[model samples]
Target: MPEIINISDAEDPRVAPYRDVRERDLVGREGLFIAEGEVVLRGLLDSSGHRPLSLLIAEKRIGGLADLLERVPADVPVYAAGQAVMDAIAGFPMHRGILGLGARAPGVAAADLLAGLPARALVMVLVGIANHDNVGGLFRNAAAFGVDAVLLDTTSCDPLYRKAIRVSVGAALQVPFARLGAGEDALDVLEAAGFTSFALTPSGTLALAQVRRPARTAVLFGAEGPGLPAEIMARCAGVRIQMSAGFDSLNVATSSGIVLHHLAEAIA
Candidate 1:
């Protein structure tokens, strides 16, 4: 069992990492990330890709989380605080009263992640997806469909963002992801790995359902309004979801789920 420390003061130096979360979230957490709520914390404990540094919980909630706490590594510090102190430390009311500070495992290059995949594989590539909620939703969908991995362009938001982790219900922690190095082209990597890349776009030349699933498939999604760039789509096979007359596109996250579901069914 991990040691449980009691925190009476919000400013206690030991708990400084959890202080002013909102402010730190804007500025970035150095190498650490905040995992919020019971579900995300549970995900943290279960994930091998992230290491939990510490946990902060409301004193009242400790009994309920005893079994969950047992899974935490012996050396990790677990801190308990009253609701008021918790709120003060976080600079907001933490109703669920569970927060974890975690560090991501050492970075894996995009090429390495792709090379490690089995012969038959499915992956998602995200480009310029800045919205945290959308990024989270994409991971949740990717996990649901058993995607081999997710590759993000450098412009995308961090999946480890607190809100993204909460939004994904911890799927972000479970899924393997790597961002492209600056100036690296996503298609070049996929193509070199023998993946048939499909760019999802409103003006795609072929309907998504028409294309046969490839042994190694990589689906590319871009930001909602702009969708995938024409140049990028030109390099990959353009695929579209059939929609009503007036609607040219769907929300990026929603579109990802639909596309992933189709591909998953094909694989099944």
Candidate 2:
């Protein structure tokens, strides 16, 4: 069993990092992110790419985590408190009662991530997607469809944000991702790496049923309203999801799921 240091005061310095989590959140904590709930915590524990720094768990729920705690490093701190105290620290209801502080190497360059992919690969590229919920949902879909990695343009939001991690059920940690710098040509990078790129949009010239899955594919999606930039779409093969005549629009996440599922079926 991991050592459980009982914390009664919400102001305790040891648990300070977890305070005001929802409103203020732990910012600039040197790449550390809060993994909440049993599912997210389990993902943190299972992931080798990211490491849990410590844990802040509700005292009443400690028994439920015995098997999980065994996998945690012995040196990491496990701070336990009552539900009320946990609620006070989080500045929220604290219903989930489980949280882990974890870290991963931050700011992986898109080129470095692309260079490491296998010859036959599937990548989901995001351009100008700033919403945390959408970012999380994309990662979830990417993982579900066996995407090799997700590449985000400089305008995209960080998937490590607390809300995003929670919303993704921790897939942001499970699915590998790297962010591109400003002016970086992600399609050119993928093309040079031998990937045929597809731009998904409602106005796409090619029908979804006409797509020929490539050995290595990179599917690009943009933020909902603006969608993919015309120049970028023009550079890649454009494919559209067939939808009801009146409803050409779909949530970005929903559209990604539909497209990825179709592509996944053609995987060799």
Candidate 3:
């Protein structure tokens, strides 16, 4: 077990990194990745590319964290504090009772990712997605649906943002993502990789069940309001989910789940 430093004061400089977590997203430019709950923490630890920098646990919850503490390197700091102090330091109620700070995996080049991609790969390309939760949910869905990789467009939000990482349930750490340089948009990059681009849109020309599966299928999606850029949509095969009326569109993440699930099943 790692040495458990008892924290009595919220102002302790040693724990300052955990303060005002809500605002940390704005004040911190380099971005911070957080893994909450025992399940997510274990998942992050299992990943080869991610490592925890430190951990904070409510005094009452320390017992449940024994397995995690045992797995993490002894050098990693594991601190214990009362509920009040934990709440004050985190700037909110710490329901999970345990949180881990992990290093963000460095961004990779899109070309490099695709070059090594396997046959029958399913890739998710998110474009102009601004919402952190949606991005996180999309990552979760991508993981669930067996998407081999994720590619982010120039306008997408940072997937490693603290909130995003928390919502992804550590799936963000598990998924391999790379960004394209220059004008190589998500659709263009997929095309270059011999992947057939499938855009998820309400006004899409083909329904989800109608499209033929390609050996490599890269699904492109965007945020709710604007949907995918018109130019980007022009480059891919347009497809829509079969949905009921009264609902204009699903949240980008929800739409992604449906598309990825069906596509993954098709591929399988």
Best of the candidates, TM-score: 1
- Pairing residues by index, what is the TM-score of model 3? 0.93
Which candidate model has the greater TM-score, 1 or 3? Answer: 1
Which regions in candidate 2 have their CA more than 4 angstroms from the true location? 25-29
Q: Which 10-residue span in candidate 1 carries the lowest summed lDDT?
A: 22-31
Task: Give the candidate order by descending TM-score.
Answer: 1, 2, 3
For model 1, residues 1-268, the per-residue Cα lDDT tens digits are: 6679999999999999999887876885778999998988988898978999999999999999989899999889999999999999999998989999999978899999999999999999999999999999999999999998999999899999988888899989988999999988999999899999999988889898887789999999999887878889889889889999985658898999999999998862
User: What is the TM-score of each predicted model, taking all chains together?
Assistant: 0.97, 0.96, 0.93
Backbone clashes per model, in order? 0, 0, 0
lDDT, candidate 2, at 117 = 84
Task: State the lDDT of candidate 3 residue by residue for 154-200, as single tens digits.
Answer: 77887777778778887888889986665776666677888888888
lDDT tens string, model 2, 1-268?
Answer: 9889999999999988788888544456568788899999998888858889889999999998899889889988999999999999988999999989888856677778878888888999999999999998998898888999999988888888998888888899898888877777998888888889999988888887788788899999999999989889889988899989987779998999999998998764
Provide C-alpha RMSD values for all models, in order: 1.2, 1.4, 1.8
lDDT of each: 0.91, 0.88, 0.83
User: Model 1 segments beyond 4 Å from truth?
Assistant: none
Superposition TM-score, candidate 1 onto the true structure: 0.97
lDDT of 2 at 256: 92
